[model samples]
Target: MTPTRRGPKKIDYVGAQSDGTKLAADLPAAVQVPDDAVAWTAVLGESTVRNLHSPDWKTREHALQAVMRSLGNARWNAERSPEDVWNTVTQLLDKALKDKVAPLYYASLELLSTLVATYSPNLPYGVLTQGLEPLMPTLLHRVGNNNARIQETSIQALLTLANQPALGLAFLAPHALSAIPKKSQSGAAAAIQMSGRLELITCMLNVQVQQQMGFGTAGRTPAAAAAAGKGGDALMAEDVVRFTRPALDMPDDKVRTAAVRLVAEVYRTRKAAGQPFEVEKMVGAGLKPALMQRLA
Candidate 1:
């Protein structure tokens, strides 16, 4: 009888080869790649970054997929070093986020959100500090990006960045909004924009209270639990009183409700923590006046 034919051994297969020299043979003849591909990250990472910037959407999609997969692989610890990943991909992300192609921009933002969620503590100090701190001004500028999808995406990115406490407080401080002068009038085109911003800030205040209460996966520093880092302690109220005026004065119903909820959440958390709070007084003093001003 003739000898039975047998399938090729698994070792002979070249797909996603664990070793390099063998895989190299499978690449197209005209495609040039580095010889030391066993160093997977070095070989594919640069190419992946390049593909993200390529004009073709297919190329960008494949590159983003490759990056997503690499971020999950144990052998790819290089991506965990946030500084290195930032250096490799920052320019590409900035361009892609601004790309006319919606998918490209959305995917780019997803990558950043992933970086923040997965690599928070490990992210490079200088990169996180230098890169993220300047984000609010940039985001405020881009608040009018292509449309609501991009605007919402920008807000999500900002929230993700705020997973870092210091970064979060940097933007939430009243000083951050001090630049936008208070607008008491309505019917101006800016009213619509103003409403959206007030709603966003209200969301932030609630989140800060949640984070401080340990209801979140992470939280801000203890100083966040108090109101003062200044003076002889007369004005240190353990809450941001100055900003309450703007939140209450916001003409939007949702904005006022959010502002009340913010105050309520702070009251709830402080009570739980055994810290003193004057909910009635703050409401009477700040909210009542602003409500009257809003109606009148």
Candidate 2:
């Protein structure tokens, strides 16, 4: 027994071949975006865009909604052409806007937001400007929808649109002066509460990043620095007065928490910069106490 010692066999993972031939470990996957029309046609047909718009078959409507929801994951690979993908998405969005079914419409908006997140910024602005703008009022109405999920999805769509500065300003400019009066419905309140928190946090971080980078300085090498400064200034000036103040006083704890965090971040940034910590001036009107409590 002492004389018998068997050593472990060394397995070469890299060198191991499936057959007699050498394996190409780094080879790309075989399935790719086809240049031909067949693949896209199949995707279009399978997406049930037409069926979702049909007035008949309630079950088809539901099924189409689910398919639209899942469409976000279908094009994960970079094989599809941007034009083809955008066309398909725009078609789906068009049908969704026309559909009387609320679920289908919500799913479509969710897919649109996913497209914004996943795709390059070079996507046709016409789609957003022409197609989406007309739908904004309807979408805003849906933000107070009875269904919590629908309302949330609508908020997400708005936030996604807001990522594009031109689109954001266009959409907001009209409504910025108008009051975003609280909805009578509880579901709408819940949705606004959730979405407002997310928007506030994003805005705060954006301003902080701009401030850290010294955005407006002439010595900055990147042209984007000056643009960032201008953008940050605009966001703080507009949002602090409009969105942030309202959010700070929201009835929901989550909304208040996010508003507080934003106020605290702004206060800290200004303090560090030797700028006046004018909490009252920043928050405006009635939110000083809540903002102060959060900062403390």
Candidate with maximal TM-score: 1
Candidate 1 stretches greater than 4 Å from native: 1-46, 79-81, 141-151, 164-189, 217-290, 293-296
| lDDT, residue 296, model 2 | 56
Report the C-alpha lDDT of model 2 over 78-173, residue by residue, as the tens digit.
556656666666645553544444544655576677665555254544554544554555555555454566656666676566545334432433
Full-model lDDT for every candidate: 0.49, 0.49
Local accuracy of candidate 1 as per-residue lDDT tens digits, 76-123: 755355566554445344444444455655676777676556554665
Least accurate 10 contiguous residues by lDDT in model 1 = 8-17
Q: In order, what is each prediction's RMSD in angstroms?
A: 13.6, 16.9
Each model's backbone clash number: 1, 0
Per-candidate TM-scores read 0.56, 0.48
